[model samples]
Structures are given as structure tokens and as C-alpha cells.
Target: MSATAAPPRAAGRPRRTSVVRTELRRGVGPWAGAAVAVTLLVTMYAKAPAWQGRWTDATDTLHIATALLAGPLTLAAGCWQGGRDRRRGTLELLRSVPRGRLRRTLLAVAPSALWPVAGQLLATTVCLLATWPYVGGGRPYLELVAADAVALASLGTLGHLVGLLVPWRLTAPLLAVAGYVGLAVGTYTESPARWLSPAVEHASPWEEPVWWFAPASAVWTGGLALAALLAYAARPARLRLLALLPLAAAVAAAVPVLRLPAEGPWRPDPETTRLVCDDGAPGVCVNALDRALLPDISQALAPLNERLRGLPGAPARWVGGANAPGAGEIGLPDHTMDAVRGRLRNPDLYLNSAVQWLFSDICDSGGVTEADAERLADVHLAVSEWLAPTPEDYGVPVGPGAQRHLDALRAGSPAAQRDYLARYLVADRCDPEEVPVP
Candidate 1:
């Protein structure tokens, strides 16, 4: 037996990675990826200050940029890629290959479906890194970024299928426009269905998304894309029934999303909402997210703190976040508007905010006559002005009467000013009649 029959050469499957690499090189994949990256970078760069020092703002901005700008671009690129075989008269040649139709379709779609996701991930990495040095608390939401990537891949796959079905030359551009309009309208809708769209806005940077939202969103978008691909590409008609599996998964995932509250997936983030206080007679406290800004905030409010020191009914603490002001505490105004790069953009404006909060308790104007209401309002204005003069360009309406009262209060000795503030602090603002006339 001249041979233990030389071991038969094993048949090997073509290397999937090699095929993908080839497709990426020859197809529009790199261009698509580059376009997405450039788009995201440009948009984020334009609004750098808005998201620079906050993790929530950074992630939310990236999500928005991906959905609004990169999503349509990916769809267009996928559509163009899908139509290439037919346009080049290679569809028949592709069909003649020994590979199964589904396998062939997947290989052809590799470039279109994967590139945009890669681009998004790349952009996300860059942004999170940029935000790392600036942010004070709370980690980036990596799951949300992953969910966005999945959504982009799904969009690309869907666009590819659409291109295969529609032979029109303008299909790619038209589809892109439609995708943009649909996503834009979804973002503005009051209906809960807007949550299904990946472009939903997140207004509150202090809130964290629920744990399950990112996974559910991934399933919803990914399932639909997979089901559509199987339905269109499966060779045997019976195998198309397998599409039901992912379609069902998509429907199941959609139910919870549709039932989500108007706030979408977010809840108060404890870490971000937790208070970090500075040592003072009347301690100054800000949320942990703004912990780095504590010294700045404490310094800004120093003058007001001195004026209220040891006065009855004066706030024992100045606190921020959702914490309710207690018997001897006053709620701090949202400092986000006044802060930039971990410091107050305008300390005067911030001081003005604290002064406004000091007088924010609702007064039962119902008991006060119109003329008295007007007078109390003027006195309130004067007190506010004396504490923190509204920046001249800040646009607050300051009447001459309030101006005169403010000047009088300012010209008084420190002891007299303290005595007046002590009485004013204890007066029941609700009873406008009891409010001290400044």
C-alpha cells in the first residue's frame, strides 16, 4: 500500500476576513467611514464648549450628531454600494458563484453595513477622551454609544436592501433626504414613538439612562435589520420563515420603548446629583458633577454669605441639584448657564442667580392689592439689586424707584445694612404687607 493514501487534502472555506478586506478596499467603505468621522468631528468641534466639561452633554451631543448627520450619509453610501452590482452588469456573475445567495449577499454588504458603525465608534472614542480631562464626575455612557453604532449599522443594511429593489439612479440621494426628514420629525414629535428613533434629544445632563434602554434599543434596531436581510437574501423560500425570529424580537423590544415615559430612558443620576459642599458658616454646596467648580462658586457667593451670616431665617446652606431647600437652606440656581470649563463664565451673573433664589419663595399675591403688589415687587427688585446688581447688559427691567432704593441701601453703613437684612430675612414674603420696604 504505497500509500496510506496520502491524507486527503481537506476542503477549506474561503477566509471571510480576506473577502471583507477586499470588499472594503475596492468598495466605498473607507469613503463612507471617513465621511461619517469628518461629519461628527466637525459638528462636535463647532459646539465644543457646550459639551467639553460634562460627560452627559458629550455623549448626548455625539448621539445627536450620529443620528442626524452621519445616519443619512451612511444610508446614502449603502444604497450606492447595493446598486453597484446591477449598475455594473455583474449581478448575473455574482449569482453564478458557488457560494449561497445569503453568503454572497452578506459578503457584498460587509463594506456598507460595517463601515458606518466603525466610524461612529471611532468618533465616540475621540470625543470621550476629549471630555475626560474636563469632566469632574460621572462616567461616559458606553452602552448608549454602542446602541448608536447598532442603529447606524441597521440603517445601512436597510438602505442596502432598498437600493437592490429600486433601480432608479437617484434612489440613493432621495432615500438620504427622506431618512433625514423622518429622523428630524421623529425628534420633534410628542408621541412616545419618537423613542424608537435613535435621534431622540436628551435635555437634562444630570440624568442617566435606565440600564435596559441601550440593550433594548440595540435589539429593536438590529433585529429588524437582520430579519430584513434574511427575508431578502435566503435562497430557499422556506428558510425565509426564519425571518420571523428576529421580527418577533424587534416587536418585543419595541413594546417597552413605546411605553417609556416622556423623559425617554433617563433617571436622576445619584452621583451627579450628590452634593459636594465647601466649609463655611453657611456652607456652599454644588452637585458632585460640578465639584471642581465649588471653590469658584463659594468665592462668588462670599459677599452674599457674609451679609446673611448669623441672620434669622437666613439659609444655613446654599445647595444645588434636586435637593429641596430645607428650613434653613436655599436652593442654588442651575449653574450650568454661568459656567464654562469648570469656572464661572460670569461670577456677577451667577451671584445674581443666587440672589434671585433667595427671594424665589412664592408670595400669596392674592392677599395683596394691585398697588401693594407693585410696591412689594419694587422692594423685592431693590433688595435683589442691592445684593447683586443685575449686569447692565443682562436685560433685567430695573425701574427708577428700585434703583433709588438700591442706591440708598448700598450707601448705608455695613451695620445698618445688616440690621435691615435681618428684619427682611425674617418677614413672611407670602404676606406682601409684612415684607420690609427696602
Candidate 2:
């Protein structure tokens, strides 16, 4: 029985799971994760109203928070962790271990690289869950979130390497501050290179990111980090040449990012931007992303719509988005400002917005004299105020003359008011001569 040939066992390989558990237990791993979670949750709590009911807003806010706050914290934490072996005077012992230098470095770097990402993912899950019920359409951008996690891990690894190379204790804090400043500056730059920074801001809530952008960003940041690790941790000097492969990959990934427009990676999202209309005479159409708010918006605009319904030249549709208003359509003001948790916070304020949208066309002041412009402005204000009275708390400036006109319009019989509105709707606002008096 060949003495029951013992199962061939690998010589000195440590169990990966045991090593990972030990790494996570010791060092800054657990603390870093807790700090990141606490910081993100607190920041998101303070700004909850801005993103509570909107998927795009929620994701964008999370991205910004990760890039600005969590990222720096991770870098500092990684730097602190990297210096641990040196601080404990275990560098010689680590060097003398049978494990390969690269393996040792990777094991040591694990806590720094993985903890921050885990924390961010946890925070992201909480935020997305909170936003789920309130949001009507459009899914959260998980790809972008994944890319942000990769960027955090890359920053952590780089900070770890810096910690190993730089002996000073102050390097962590200084690096964190520098990282924040660099990210903030990149956000404001006009150059396309700003896209390379993980902190790029997205201004349009209706837009989705380009399909390839997130993957490219992950590759760009991850490749650079891997390259650095290979160059530094490889045993023989000749093996360091292998770092060039990842370095080349990083450069290749950066090309498309560098070629991106100043607006970064976003493109118009047809699904989110598609119009979802109510069944009213002068239909109210909000973007699909805000479809849940349609009932509230329609109710808020009901009075104005009642007045405009069946009138000549009145808008056939009150449409929200970048779409140009056609012959029988008018652009709707952004309703997101008036909404809180998918409900209208102030209906009167929203009504005022609709009234303003009815007159948003800019007339060439160049053609009109100052006095005419002032008169036109007052008449416009009176008409607007009559259509939808400004909320008292808004502190809207109303001149005595405009107030008198508004009062008169309100005091008039329904027939008279309707007659005046009929003429006003057909008037070309750009021409002072064409505008009807209130």
C-alpha cells in the first residue's frame, strides 16, 4: 500500500483567508472603514434634501463626497498603515520571511487598499436604498460608483507606497491635504484633463454617463496603481521592467479620457429625458425621471392651465427638459427645486415658476428705450403676479404701480380677465408695440 502516499502539500503557503482576516483585524483597516462610513453618512445627512428623491442627484452627490472627503481619508489612513512595519522595527523580519517580497507587500497593502472601498460601497448601498422609494424613474449609476471605489483603492495603494518611501510621520496629513486640493482644482478646470481626476462634477441631472467612461476610468487609475506596486515590490531589478506593461495600459486608458469634452463623460439620457404628459387640456409634461411629481405639478399649474385652456396661442403642452418649445408648447421651469422627497414643497412657488416660464423669452433691450423697457417689465410683472401670486415669504420686489395693476386684474370680472389674457397670449413679448396692457 505504498505507505498511503501522503497528499502532496504545498510547502509554506499561508492560507489567504487567514492572512486577510489578520490584516483586517490589525492595523488601520477597521478604523479606516468606520471613519469613511461615518464621514460619508454624516455628509449625506446634511445634504439629504438635495438628493433624497433623485437617483442622478444621489449618485452625483455620493461621487463628489467620495472623491473629496473619503478619498483623502483613505490616502492618509493608507499612509499611516504603510509606515506600521517600519514603526514597529519589523522591516528586517519581513525581509527575511520565505514569502516573496511582492506577496508580502500585497498582504501588507491589503488593509489600506480594500477597507476604504468596502466602506464606500457600504455607504453607497445605504444612500441608494434611501433614495429608492422616492425616485420614480432612472436607475442609479452603479458603474460610476464602481469606478469611484477603484479610484479610492488606487489612491490608498499609492499612499501606502508613499508611506513606505517617505519616513516622516507628517507625510500622511500633508498628502491628504494635497490630495483634496488637487481634486478640488481639477473640478474647476476647463481642460479635458480634468476628467482624469475622479472628482469631476456632473451638472446635468437628466444626462447619463457615456458607456465606456467608467471602465476607462477604472483602468486608468487601477493600471497606474498596479504599475507602481510591480515596480516597487518586484524582487530583482530586472523584474521591475514588467511594470512597463501596466504603465502602458494606464497610458492607453488615459487617451480617451483626455479626448473627452469639458463636460466630462455625460450624454443626454433619452429615457430620463423622455416626456411623460398628464391628460389635462394644456398637458403638463415632466421628464420621466420626475414622473412621480407630475400629479403635484399638474395640480400646482391647474389654475394657470384653467385660464390658458382653449385660448388661442396658449401652450398646448407645458414640457420640461431641453427640448425647444414648438408652436403650441412652452418650456417648464425646473420643478426639482420646488420638490422635496418627490412632493411639491410649495405649490404657490411652483405656480409662480410656471408663470415665469410663460414669459422667459428675452426681448432685445437694444431695440427698446429704457422707459419702454421699464414699462414693459412692470406690465409683465403685473401679468405674472395676477396669473400666480408670489408667495409672501419669497420677498419678491413689487413696485406700487405693478401692485395696482395686479389688484385691478384680480378685481376684474372673469370675462374681462379672460379677454385680457387672450390678447396677452398672442402678443409677441419681444416687440413692446405688440404687447397688450394689463
Candidate 3:
């Protein structure tokens, strides 16, 4: 019979669906994925900042740390995977039997490229889930997650290409150490490259991860990743030159971030400045960041509110600010535990902050006579002690002069002391320099 036309497909050809699985079974395995997961989790814990009361914060921090810590390991894994054939002395044998050289090269590279990303993403996903019960606002910025994955994937490909070029056993470890140093230097220096290190970003009351960074970082790293993957998989020497096109593209994409000034990868979200209010008197408003803190804050301030119940010009609301809080307004700490992280780790500071806010610049009455200012200054500690008589302020080490004044105030009728205290508080507006005690 006449030879029939060759069948449209070959039965022995490796199916695309099986490539990753085949690579995993033959070379890559759960160990690499597990190592990645453990390393990322450890990094997250070791440098983990106090939780910023936002879901976006939890997710970004996990992935940012994963991006930083997993990078070198991914590079090592890639190097190890890329040199496998050379290490086993099977490169010639594999070349002879391959369905195609590019396909074979891809088969070698696929596992290293994809596995670490999967592991890091899994770790980040687990972290995001942990925040579900506590963090209520903001969606998981999956864009940042995607950027982290691409950055890691690209790192893997670059390392793999480096391994293929230099097949020594030391190549992998040395490359990892070099990668780690590069990361470290990037963090400590002034070059634009430093921002590229995806280490954890501290959140502020006014800002969050910038919206555009997701796309910018993805494009930058993805381009470089494509270039390296193409360079590694290219069968013909001439085709390797094509890698430069993507490399150049990556360089171009990085310019905007590189040019950015030192202050931020975040922009102030207007929502953070809007007032969030509580139910009753001595009203309180916190920025979006501190809204979660409002209940605790209000309850803490209840006693102070009671003291101000009938007083003129007593602050009616407390808000986050450096100043310019309206009249009868109190400004929270400039550091404002508003951005206080991690399970209110600084609650004592928050309380101290509240007390400080009310007492801040209390002696600055603009119209006071010099003599009145001097008189006001004399009793300043007395007024401050009344605001918060905590041990730190009223206890030992206070000067004898201040102690005598405090004792005198305490010695007088409680009624007279209250009358004097009330007079001083209102005097900032009405009588610029009246003292608070008898």
C-alpha cells in the first residue's frame, strides 16, 4: 500500500498538560515548595511589624516579605534545576533523544520557575486568611500579590539562566549569596534599585500601597523574566540575542519607580482623612486608619469627657493631626497610635498619648501678659498633674519646688482647687494667664 500521509499528531509527544507534573515528579518536588513556604513564613514572623489595622496591610506585608526572602532561595532552586543535566552528565544523551531542544530546555526550566511562586502565594494566602476575623476594611490587594509572584518567577528564571551558563556545584550557592548581598545593598543605599527590594513597607495613617505600583512592578519584572526564560530556552545561539529586547523593556519600565523620591511607594488615600464618628458627647473622629481604634479611644477618654461636661472651651472632639485641629479640639499624638501596629502593642503609649494631647501647648495663651505668663508657667506642672496624676508625672524625682506647689494645691479645700483648675482651663481663651490652683 502507498505510504499514507504522516498522522497529524505523534502519540509519543509530551503533552503540554503534563510538562509541569512531569518535571515535578522527575526533578522538582514538594521539598522545594515546602522549603519556600517555611522560609517565607519565618521571614514574615522575624521582621513582622505590628499589624496596621487594615486587611491591605496584612496581605502586603506577607507578600512583601515573601518577595524579599524567597528571592534568593528561588534563585538557588533555579540554579540547581538548570544545572541538573550537566551535573548528571546527561546533557548529550538528553540532546540526542529530545523531541525538540527548546521543548526539553523548557521542561527543565518550568518546575523551577513556577514552584516557588506557588509556595509563596500559598503562604501569603494563609496570612491573608488569618486577618479575616479581625480586619474589616480594604480588599486584599491581589495586585501586589500578583506582582510578588511575577517578581519571584522572574528571579527564578534569571537564576536558572545563570546556572545554565555556569554549571559548577558552587554556582547555585554563590549565586544565592550574591543575590542576597545585592538585596541587602539595595536596602541600605540610595540608588533607585533599593526600592525594588520588596521588603515590608510600614503603613501610615494617611497612606497605603500606591495603586499604580502593581502594574509597574508586574511589567518591569515580567519583562525581565521573559527575557531570561527566552535566553535559557533558546536552542539557537543567534536567537539568544532576542532576549535583549525584553531586558531593555524591563529597564524602561523601571524608570518611573526609580525616579520616585525617597518618601514613598504609597500615596495618601483621601479616605483616611475623613471623619469617623462615635455616638455621643465629647464627639470623636478618627481617620479611616484609626476608625477601628475609636471604641477603645472613646471609652478611655470617658472620664476626661466627664470632667469637661460643663466647662467652656473644653475640647469637644479628638482627631488625628499635627495641629490645626479646630477650637475646642484636641489633636492626637503626632505619632498618633493611629498607625500603632500589631495588637495594640503600644496601648500604654496610646493612653499616654491621649493624656499628652490634651495637655499639649496648654501654656500657650496668646494674649497673656508677661507677668500672667510667668504665673501660668509656675502652675503648669500642677495643671498637668491634675490632667494625669500617673506615677511618672506626680511621683518621685519631681523637683522640690514643684512638689511644694503640688502639696499646697492638695492641701487647700478640694472645692477651691477645682475652682482654680476650672479658671485656668478657660483662661487660655478668656483670661490668657490665670493659674489653675489656689
lDDT (CA) per prediction: 0.88, 0.90, 0.68
The stretch of ten residues in a row with the least summed lDDT in candidate 3 is 335-344
lDDT by residue for model 1 (59-161), tens: 9999999999999999999999899888998999989988899998888888788998888888888888888887878888999999999999999999888
Query: Model 3: clashing residue pairs?
Result: 50-342, 51-342
Best-first order by TM-score? 2, 1, 3
Instruction: Residues 1-438, candidate 3: write the lDDT tens digits.
Output: 458867556778777777668776666535666778888777666544544356656775676566556888888888888888788898899889746766777777777778888888888877766666555344567888888888888788787778778978899889888887776666776666666665535455355567777788888888978887777777688888988998897888788888877775776666656677786577767665556667766666666666666666677777763125887778765443334442444444465556656755634456667866655544665555555554553344555556667788778785776666677666642243243444
Worst 10 residues of 2 by lDDT: 320-329
C-alpha RMSD (angstroms) for model 3: 4.9
Better TM-score candidate (1, 2)? 2
Per-model TM-score, in order, reads 0.91, 0.92, 0.82
- Alpha carbon lDDT at 369, candidate 1: 89
C-alpha root-mean-square deviation, candidate 2:
2.7
Residue ranges of candidate 3 with Cα displaced over 4 Å: 1-15, 46-49, 189-193, 197-205, 259-265, 321-324, 334-349, 362-378, 391-418, 427-433
Q: Give one digit per residue, the lDDT tens place, for model 2 in 173-265.
A: 999999999989987888899898999888677899999999999999999999999999998889999999989998999999999876778
1 or 2: which has the higher lDDT?
A: 2
